[model samples]
Target: MIFYFSGTGNSAWVARQLAEGQNEELLSIAVEIDKNKEYKLREGEKVGFVFPVYAWGPPEIVLRFIRRLKMIKPEYLFFVCTCGDDTGRTAQLFSSAVARKGWRCAAGYSVTMPNTYVSLPGFDVDDEDVETQKVHNAVARVRFINEEIVSRVQTKHYNCHEGALPFTKSYFLRPFFNTFLMSPKPFHATEACIACKKCEKACPVNNIKVTDRPVWGDNCTQCLACYHICPVHAVEYGKVTAKKGQYKGRLLRDL
Candidate 1:
């Protein structure tokens, strides 16, 4: 089984491709979290976790879900992280977290996808051509990962960088990110909002409430779902996002 958490469909696309290629069951972490039940992996089963990199590490929601998960001894375990630039030490961090639960990580992989974090300065969504290329490359990489998983290849570690700086950056930035970047204080719906409540529904954490417009709660993953999935493009993360391009990996019709 492959459990995945996606904010704006980048990791979702990767998870779907991997599941289709490997003939494995695909599970949504968001859905599971909503179910509010512990998940138990079957004995001797192959398991995988797929998610996007958040501040060089796993998102807060993903971490919480993994900690609460109950699983038996799986024959193989792996993780795949999707990122716009590099995954930093996201895989290693996840491995360490799961190790505390007595599960050994067999392999880790990273796939570069379109940049969807448009809130940051100097960062915008990639162009259509670039996103297309990224999707093509990601599909190929997922296929290779599927082959390795079938062979049960045990990769001890994996990272976007070969040096130690990525590790240092990830370790230091993760705490800061958890403290500041994950908050929903900066989010506000614009005048274009139709009070559709799509943002509230799209929020995986259920942190959004729609009244006259939409009110953001403190529990936010900074998943970009509210911004990217908004039909009227009314959700804005401060003034910077007004000029930033929006991307959700797939068209609204496709979604």
Candidate 2:
């Protein structure tokens, strides 16, 4: 079974590709394994995880899900993280967690995507082909995952993307970041918006509610789901971000 948690469809996109290529069952960590839920794993089943990288590590939701997960003893396990840049040492976080659960991590990888956490305005990745290349490369990475799983190679250590280190203390600096990043105040629809409601469906966490005016809740993780998925190029993070280049949720076929 392939388990996935995605906020901006990056992780989910990769997970679906891997499952399709490997002919595996897909499971959503967001809905299937909630705060209180049990997992059903058959003997000799292979388990995999695909999630987004956040703050140089796993997202808060991924960590919380891992903590609450009742994992079965799978014969194989793997992980893939969709990140904007090099996620140095962030992959190690998962290795440690799975170890604590008495589950061996077979293999892991990180793929790049557009950095959507708009609260961190400075962390922008403007490469036009970044998302497309990420999708293509992730498809190839599945081959490596399958090989490692077949070998039963347990990974105790994972590598980090170069220079992708944690800057400030998340506990202390996160509040300031979240205050501005997680709120609905920053996102405003322009006249270009048609109220298409694509943003509402794209929200993995269901943080966005579209009505006469869009509303966001404090539960947002700044994943930029709404901004990227907006079909009309209507959603934006304010004047500063609009100048930097607003995200309009471009896909491969959309090109």
Q: Which stretches of candidate 2 lie over 4 Å from their true place?
A: 114-117, 129-136, 159-181, 246-255
TM-score to native of every candidate shown: 0.91, 0.81
- Predicted candidate 2 versus true structure: per-residue lDDT over 1-255, tens digit per residue: 888988766677778777875667998876875558677877777788888876666776777778788867677888888776766556667877888888777778776656665545575645667756764665566566555555656766553353523444233444454454556677787888787888888777777788865777766666777877776667887764564555444563342
Clashing pairs in 2: 88-161, 89-160, 228-249
lDDT of 1 by residue, 1-255 (tens): 899999888888788877886678999998886566755666566888899988888887888888888767678888888888876778778988899889888888888888888877888898999988877777677788888878878985563432347776688867877776666788998899999998899888788999999999887889899998888899999887997777866732242
RMSD of each: 2.3, 3.3
The TM-score of predicted model 2 comes to: 0.81
The ten-residue window of minimal lDDT in model 1 covers 156-165
Compute the lDDT for candidate 1.
0.82
User: All candidates' lDDT scores?
Assistant: 0.82, 0.69
